[model samples]
Target: MNITDLMWKNATAYGYTFTRTPPDAACAARVTLLEWLDAGRINPAVARVFPLEQAAEAQRHLIEDRPFGRVLLTLAR
Candidate 1:
């Protein structure tokens, strides 16, 4: 399926607008998105963190719906 079809499917399933097309004003939109993120207005739940090497395992956990929030992959410094 193409991007449009995929978007339609998702929108129908979730009852929301899913756009396959890119925004015409991406630069301005990106600035807005960044501002929201920095302002804590777009905070996402963090379920768990794993080392980069365990990313695959984390994905599996997410796929199984074991995580309650977003899973993050961290790199050891």
Candidate 2:
């Protein structure tokens, strides 16, 4: 199936479940992520840390759909 067909199927199956977010909703999402991180609700097993210099490489890995969880860039030590 093509992109449009996939999107229509998803929409029909999960009516109104996907939509653009307002500014406030975006802020709320950021806050929720921060809270989850602070509360240690996010599992380390699902996280990958990389140095700033390797950010491009990280993006390539993600775009290629390499195996892993969240990819993060960190400051140099």
Task: Assess candidate 1 and give its TM-score to the true structure.
Answer: 0.53
All candidates: CA RMSD (Å): 7.7, 6.3
lDDT per residue for candidate 2 within 1-77, as digits (tens), equals 25698787775433222147787887788788789988999655545677999999878877886645678889977
| Cα-based TM-score, every candidate | 0.53, 0.51
Q: What is the per-residue lDDT of model 1 for residues 10-66, given as tens digits with 9 covering 90 to 100? A: 754333222643676665666777899999888767999889999999989899877
Judging by lDDT against the true structure, name the best candidate. 1
Segments in model 2 whose C-alpha atoms lie over 4 Å from true places: 1-19, 44-47, 63-65
**Candidate 2 local accuracy as lDDT?**
0.72
Model 1 CA lDDT for position 21? 33
